[model samples]
Target: MTEPKNLALRENKVPEPTASFWTIKVLATTVGETAADLISSRLHLGTQLTTVVMVALFLVVFVVQFRSRRYVPGLYWLTVVLISVVGTLITDNLTDGLGVPLAVSTGVFAVALMATFAIWYATERTLSIHDIVTRRRETFYWLAVLFTFALGTAAGDLLAEQLNLGYLASAGIFAAAIVIVAVAHFVFRLGAIAAFWIAYVLTRPLGASFGDLLAQPTSDGGAGLGTIVTSVVFLAAILTLVIYLTIARSRRAVPAKDRQTGIEEPAGV
Candidate 1:
């Protein structure tokens, strides 16, 4: 139902979302939570100041991302990483700074995300990332990304705080949910849009829970690895992987044929 201009595919385009895309997404979200904690708790900036600095960084990274014509792993992943931090901070501000309950924030963000999807679908007619060639679609994509992070933070906190599932258990639950979505998509012919959104939403909580598991104190039921250590370790790994993928993709780039025959694997791998 999308207009012809909106539906038109970009020649030589990279596939929109892929397995590697999700993998990197999960990693980025985890890094976001840990990194923000490192800067705030370890460095003693406090959440408010940290949020301001992180949002600025995210904007700078996004400018670079918007300027790129083709998918560049480093730039794209950088934007994701920064956005994750900013998103987490946004939720934290609402909950901790403004005294909004986690449940309320979660519900609010869920409604906002749904509204974003509705408007995006009504305007673009398709949510498929397979053919993202326009600025409008890209804008909607990032807005959704921001909301997903905020929603994930609230949901993760709700489970851990209200339900007392603990970080490890919460992470396990989210991971299992993601697996179920994957199975439903691959085995049961689930709609791609539904599967993608479900999985996308699940990754936020999964990453958040895992981040807490690594960074929380042993008294708090974590390994006590410390946020600084966890953030540094994950950021290094992500940077190395992004660099490798960038080099590899550049070396072996190929032309796109059609969705039927020329489907390339996702951007990460």
Candidate 2:
């Protein structure tokens, strides 16, 4: 695939895939599930109102994210956290508010995700996050991410609630799937891009199942942590990690003279 043209910045719009990246991503997914529950169920805002408020907030943050020239850890991850919540809300709306079956929601989101990827590949000739330097590519990247979260939510809930697998079992299943993907990528030489996206999609379900395992009551086969406690703990962890990432990125950045002399520093998490 060709390199993205007219690249005004050295860094990709998205962060590099690192251990920290996956850590924050999974944390964000867990927060998405529990925080949505906290707002809609615990806080008495109702699903419909919470969705509207969150969508508005997401658009506002999204514009800020789009206007940035390079990845800013705080802004970038804020967008991710918000999008995660929005995605969960979308799936919840489908199943709870609209009375749609979890299986149907899962199927619909999977197809939508596939369609987004198809169009993304057709238009850009690539689906690598490393290539997300332009607005159009970033748009596709976020669309794919949104669909993955929604799809994962449906699939996780279908297994945990509908099929009576329970939250812990669902978490175990998705975790195994992620482990298999890692083995394929590291040992079997799966393509980096494919492995990354597949694992990315899997993390959503894994994180959601974990969140539910903590947040739901003991009768529901969970640990009885409740949504508020789970959301607070995860969000705090996310904030700490993002702060470290921001500091690390600043320290890794090269001086203007180095940039002018064409000394390219290797990218980091």
Candidate 3:
């Protein structure tokens, strides 16, 4: 791997394999789907308008995130949530507004994600999230994140809507896929970085499915929680976790070695 820019920046990322990390990630993704749905369907923003507004919001938050000197859990997770919403809106516009087929959207996003990864790896010679110290790597990381959400949105809709798998069924399938990745990492010797990205991509769909399951009505095979209610619940969960992390950081209680997340100490970090 090439030399990193700042060791301190290295600590800002790379830890994502913990229970709390996964919990917050899942909550953020769930809110992403339901919140976007809320704005488009409930508020009647229309796909184009919603996309514009959400993209603008994401850029604002992302600018703040990019300018940060180190990891601020609130800023980081808030950026993730906004990007998730924007990503969902992008896919929704392509499939629902533009009359594009789900299969086609899925294929296109899959190709796009692969291309991003290919270029990222080719340029950096390392795909480890731990190495994201330079501006270039950070750009690649955010780009990869955007593609993951968009691709997952397309693929999830392909399975749940196009394939008629139902929300629960689709969520179950992706959740099971995540479990398999976990097993492969711990039991079957899968590379940690590979497993992390695979599970990360899978979680976008999995969390979205669960969001639909809770937000949709019984006729649509969901729990009838309503999109507004689901969004509030998930957003609440994310906020609580972020607060805890912030307090932990302030207390100097969050020891790097004790993070328990997927972060490993790489050389020169």
Candidate 4:
């Protein structure tokens, strides 16, 4: 069945937030946490060097992402994966390298994220990801992404270490929060942008706690899966999903035009 042209143009132009999107996001965030550990702890590169490497890789991926005319799932997911790792390292640095407490890091990142949103809204007058076509909006998007990851790391550690909740419990708490956000959005007419950012921030800790639960030693309340194994498994899953998305894109028609802007829109426009 053909979708209404207007609905196709206005509603479905941007990639729909489907099961696959969430799957890939969770896997990417898990990989982000584990991959950082793989580089810093397993390889003994130290946090500083690992952060440098991850940030450099993130830049390369971001360049590719920004250069793409439309949202290619593989490119978009790859950028997310890299940014997750880099963002984790940023918080880890403040906590480990500089000896800052998790509470302090969390508060700092929260403030920074709020500031980013405030400036973004003031300059663009809209915080909608659905309208992210301009370079300025893209910049704000990435900055917010970075802060979300950092804040998630700090918040997750605070729960796991400071509160003694353990990884499994922390993951459960975050998962519950995500559900509440979904309910608020769908049942209460919550704003789309607010719901999306709330969910996005929560996914970080959900993924981070899950990663810790899988990768930490059995004595540490984990299953002793190890960072390398966990990272590889999630990365493989992400790659498979990206490949499927790429092939699917080729089979679809040119995405419809946006009604509001009267422009050819990308899927998930």
Candidate 5:
């Protein structure tokens, strides 16, 4: 049977979040944080210059992603990685460059994320990533994603810097929070959309902490791998997975719009 043209237009062009999807998500988040540090700190480009370069790259690849007919793993995840880096840079700019407090940045990003969701739901009557077949919906999805990353970056930094939790402790805290979110979803029957977005936001800090633990110096409590080494490893891992997914064509069109308006099946959702 032919798909309804309208529905088809709004079908999600991204792959369903899967095991590998989650792996890549966390890895990309790590790379985002460390890679941003590499360019700004080690490369001596400074935050402003690094932000300009990454944003330019993001815009270029984002155009490719926006124009594609369907999910292209390379382009899709490339956009994610770029946006992730850009998101980190945005938070870093506010906190480090402008001397804005992490707590303030966190709260501001949280509000921005909430406002974006409100506007998206107000216009579409749905916040479903499944409704992403339309350009407008895709726009909302990417906006939400950007906010989540920014929020995550701010929140993570707040915990480490202001709270004095340190990277490993911060990673532990976020990891525990993710486990709680999982418990809520599976045991208490938490709404899928709420759970997804919550966990999505939480993972940013968790991944950032992990990245810092690996990349920072031993005296600073990291493993001594350094940002360049850590970023290289994570990027290599990401490259391998993207190549595999591309060759495998792991993406699947959802059987239909998610009826539950909640969490969805990997293939159909």
Candidate 6:
């Protein structure tokens, strides 16, 4: 069904945090982990150079995302995928290039993320992604997303590598953590916004650990699929889902008033 005409003018810039959103987000996060390893190792670009290239791509996509008045599934997902890579690399740089401890990186990112949310809530009076309509709110949203990724990376690596939990075990732990967050939200009546951000942060580590479990060598307790194969498989999955979401969105009618005002209302919201 088409959205009500009156509601079209207040379209949010982000997608609803539905099952599909989380599915694609986890897939994109996996791609971010495997693809970064593929580029840095298989392509011989090194982590620093790979980070530079991905950040540039992320900025370009961010421009496209910011210019769009409403959530375009393809554009929004593309931004997510790129930012995922950039966030992973940021943590990698801190841990590897600068010799920062995983615990330190994790703590720093956690603090940064908390600060971003505090400022965002203080300024906008809400931390709900559903309220991201204005540019300022969208900016805060993306910044928060970046920190989630960085923090997730550091925490995941600390568990899987530094602490020797192994990738598969790490994935299991994170997956269980997500389930606990869900139970808290649905069963214990935790706030929707709180549950969402918690789950979002947890998914990053879960996805990354799963990627490593697939991409690392068998000697390392992984499946030995290698980064290239893992990256390709997850990326193809992400692309298929994105294409489906884009078509599903396009089939919805655009509100005429919104069209006249050069604004697009998100379909299937």
Name every residue pair that clashes in candidate 6.
none
In the range 229-253, model 5's lDDT, one tens digit per residue, is 9999999999999999986764324
- Over 4 Å off, model 5: 1-10, 250-269
Candidate 6 local lDDT, 135-203, one digit each (tens): 778888999999999999999999999999999899999999999999999999999999999999999
Pitting candidate 1 against candidate 6, the one with the higher lDDT is: 6
Best by TM-score: 2
- The residue-by-residue lDDT of candidate 1 on 189-210, one tens digit each, is 9999889888888999999899
Worst 10 residues of 4 by lDDT: 5-14
Candidate 1, residue 134: the lDDT equals 71
Model 2: residues >4 Å from true position, as ranges?
1-10, 255-269
| Clash count, predicted structure 4 | 8
Residue 257, candidate 4: C-alpha displacement in angstroms: 18
Descending-lDDT candidate ranking: 2, 6, 5, 3, 4, 1
lDDT of each: 0.84, 0.92, 0.87, 0.87, 0.89, 0.90
TM-score of candidate 3 against the unseen true structure:
0.90
lDDT of 4 by residue, 75-180 (tens): 7888899989998999889988899999999999999999999999998788887876656667788899889989998999899878999999999999999999
Number of residue pairs clashing in candidate 1, backbone atoms closer than 3 angstroms, sequence gap of 3 or more or interchain: 0
lDDT of model 6, residue 58: 94
Assess candidate 4 and give its TM-score to the true structure: 0.88
Using all chains and alpha carbons, the TM-scores for the candidates as numbered come to 0.88, 0.92, 0.90, 0.88, 0.89, 0.90
Q: Lowest summed-lDDT stretch of 10 residues in model 5? A: 250-259
Instruction: Please give the distance, in angstroms, between residue 100's alpha carbon in candidate 3 and its true position after superposition.
Output: 1.5
The candidate, 3 or 4, that scores higher on lDDT is 3
Candidate 2, residues 11-51, lDDT tens digits: the string is 68998999999999999999999999999998899999999
